[model samples]
Target chain A: MTNRSFEQVSALLDDAIADTREQAQQLDTLLSDNEAQQVWARYALYGRVLKGEAAAQAPADISAMVAARIRQEAPPSQVVQGRFGKHRMARWLRPAGSVAIAASVALVAVLTVQQSQPVAPEQSVEPAFATNPLGGRSPVSYNTVLQQNAPSEAERAQQLRLLQSYMLDHSQQLQLSLQAQQLNEQSEAAAPQKDDN
Target chain B: MNNLKQQHHKKMITNAWRSSITGLLLLCGFLSSSAISQPFQVTDSNQNQAVALYDEMARALRELNFEATLVRSSGTRLEPMTWLHGVYPDGTEVELIVMLNGPDMRILRIGDDTSYYEPHDEAYTIHSDVTFGLLPAAFYKNFSELQPHYQVVGGRGVRVSGRNTHFLRILSRDNDRYHYGLWIDVESKMLLKMQMMTPQGDILEQLQVTTFVERENVPIGMSDVRGIPRPPRLYEVRNLRPPQFNLQPQWLPAGFELLRAGHRRVADSGLPVDYYLFSDGLTEVSIYVGSQQQQGLPSLAMQGRESIVNSTQQNLAVTAVGKVPVTTLQRMVDSMRAVEPNATQP
Candidate 1:
């Protein structure tokens, strides 16, 4: 019925058919188009040959391969508009119901996988050493470390200063542990070897 | 028929004897176990009494409007603080602790939001019930909650801070951690003096809270805090960063868990450091990890039980400061494992 049927069937084989409407509008043409039918049959035979069902040689024509490559190289499609497009689409819509079925199957697969995705637990920062972290009710002063003697008064001053700030931060920033989660996500997204280099 | 009857009677007598022997064995086992546990029960009762006093002190600390002056004694150094706690007519609790000897260091708590104003550092707030440093949370904490790892024993009554007080010796059940001896006021159930002691009964540090007043209503000192609106809830805190744990100390003494971790810089010297605070319910230690800029650091600085230990691991200078033993700190530093990150910034 139309010369473009061969190309449409080839696009369908490549899973690159853009419009369900266009394919349905040309279904009779594709069935009647001898060259398109021959390509389809050859593809089926070639698949059987792969499965060792038929002792056959390789396909003689590379037209289907060329068609798939052409489809890949083609510019992406835009929405079809205008009165004529609507007129054709209305007629093709009934047959194109099969496309919706295929889409529903794909959606089910995606949704099933989404349902299995586990959710990460929530974490909140609590007072340090005051009690059990898993929520035992206690406020016992938490005990931490020990250091050797500072070499000199100045060194001791520096150590003392560091210790003061460190302890201050230690005591003050109990909620900082919440940042660990963001740190984990950032680590995965960021490029490796960026820490020291 | 008579022989059969006699045999049946003999079997019943044997069965009864066996059953009686089994019952006797079971009774003996139970008695022995109970006898062995009788001393444990006595200790438990004594511990319970001490813990009851501790709980009373904890409740008093929370519910009472009190103004207390505290002095921290560790070796020759002495630091003082003014601790105030009160509740509003609306049931909003306010607690404030201003370090008297420090450079404008203080901590304020309004309900669950706690704020810290360190001497030269940007004052920041956290959502927590307990404040760190100065007078620790342990003083007002229920001692029974530290059980399984810690135990409390009743000690002889003694006068402390001009009040008749009873001593409640609270220590680790396994003797692997620091111990505390609290002198609680008998009448008021307030803690007057707390001694951080070692397993050897040596005092590591002592905090003496001289009770000035425990008012029935809100303390007058809290007038400054009343109507003081809570600080604006922090922005979605992405920009306000905390110290991150890039290097984690994998080993800790038993019962110690990471309480908090953050990144900060020393005000005296611009030294960026990563630190982790670990606690064992009673005592806490801070482990600081920073890049080794120059050579190694001072291996240690120990004054009494308080110690600051430094070591270099994987080009990162690690320091641990706490009131625990230096060896434990060193072991913790040695256990530093650099977290494998996809991206790292030194």
Candidate 2:
């Protein structure tokens, strides 16, 4: 892209970041006050972020801080299972633990740079491979660990079935009310000589 | 050069004199023909003579003793109604009896009050206006005023009920109202037959006299036919109250006036329906406003002599009714709106 196009893209990204921060702040306030509103807002925000909009990714430091918070507040198995599902929990946990290991290696590079030594060529590729896994088995092994440590399958299945039944019953009651209303209208039309002249 | 100038001035004077003389001669010839033809053409004289004739006709209508059968033809249906009218010599007694078949209907009018008798309903007194149907009393009260709005043309003379009649056409000046043609008796000027025509020249309704009698010797009791029970009052009607409109329209077609206004209870929701009526000397229209639901929009349906047009806004329905064209009805419906306090002329 031309320099001008690059600048335009950067400005758009800046706007997107500002808008996301405002919405996040609003969601935080709503979460403390209105439970229903907060749940709906979080679902809407998740839909926006998953739509492949490049502007959804935060700055590197902010992402790391958020990840740290998740680690501190939630058990690793719960975080892995929530994002990747119970079936895929084992696959996500293995790569996530490796990322923590890569983070420690990046700390050593920072210390070497400050000592005024040129980094070795082997160390140059270390950050890339550590941050992201390349092999397919890596994801599978990671998920297996998360699934074993998370909730049991039978408990999750029972809760899902209850929610489905409740929704079906509510819809059936609405259909019955509509049928009764139509019957009343038909009877009124049949009795024409009641009052009108 | 002097001779040429003198010749040109003489030629100009001669041409002017010749043209003026020709103009004067033409004017004289035209005036003479108009004077001679004045007696031949109907409605050539001032309205004073027509007004006098109208007064005489009204007096004859009030004083004449006659029993005639009138056949009212509308569309493909023909209805025959027998009418009996008489006036006492003392000018105090008057009676009119009209009887209809099929449904077995009879209307008896004594002075101002009228009583209707029907097979399924008991006899009861009704307002004089109801007895007239859609006929305005202004036709009988001051028909001379209509002369200005209608052309009085002559039609083929005919004989009705052994009385000599001359046809008098009352063509309307505009298509805004219906036209009428009446056959009046030459001697008494009493209307013998009348036909009402639409704008397209189609006859909507016609009342023709099959038979009529001019009675010089009639019994006094004929003017006082009694013992007829009045029809039961099936409908209790009060004058519709006028609505307090926040805005009144600044422009309306000429010859229209507010007739009545009031609220009616809608059958479905029992909500109050606002209604208003306006009339020119001839045509009448009723407008209605009410809260709109899915069914509250004005729907149109035609039954015999009546046609209704309805329209709805966000929450208001407006309906206009008359014998007017559908376009006119739609225009009236669209013009109605809730008046705002600060409405200004555009």
Compare the candidates by DockQ and give the number of the best one: 1
lDDT digits (tens) for residues B1-346 of candidate 1? 9999999999999999999999998787666545532332335456667778888988877788877777877645576766777888888788877666636455677876665544322344445555545545566567655766777777666787667888777767644466788888888887788888655566767889754466687655555553443322222235544655478877787888876555765323446777577877667788777777742354433323444556777777887776675445656776788676742546
Estimate, for each residue in A26-63, the C-alpha lDDT of model 2 and write its tens digit: 44544565654545445455557667443422322332
List lDDT for all candidates, in order: 0.57, 0.46
Worst 10 residues of 2 chain B by lDDT: B297-306
Residue lDDT tens for model 1, A1-197: 25465566667665676787876755665577787777777666766766779631221122233223323421211211222242342221111102122223332332233234322210111221223232342211111111222145465445445544444343333333323323444568785846331
Q: Which segments of candidate 2 are over 4 A away from where they belong?
A: A1-197, B1-43, B46-55, B127-131, B144-156, B160-163, B217-224, B227-251, B266-271, B294-304, B313-315, B325-327, B340-346
Classify candidate 2 by CAPRI docking class: incorrect
Name model 1 segments beyond 4 Å from true: A1-165, A174-197, B1-42, B98-107, B115-124, B138-141, B229-248, B260-274, B301-306, B337-346
User: What TM-score does each of the candidates earn?
Assistant: 0.54, 0.50
Candidate 1 chain B worst ten-residue window by lDDT:
B228-237
DockQ of each: 0.02, 0.00
Among the numbered candidates, top TM-score falls to 1
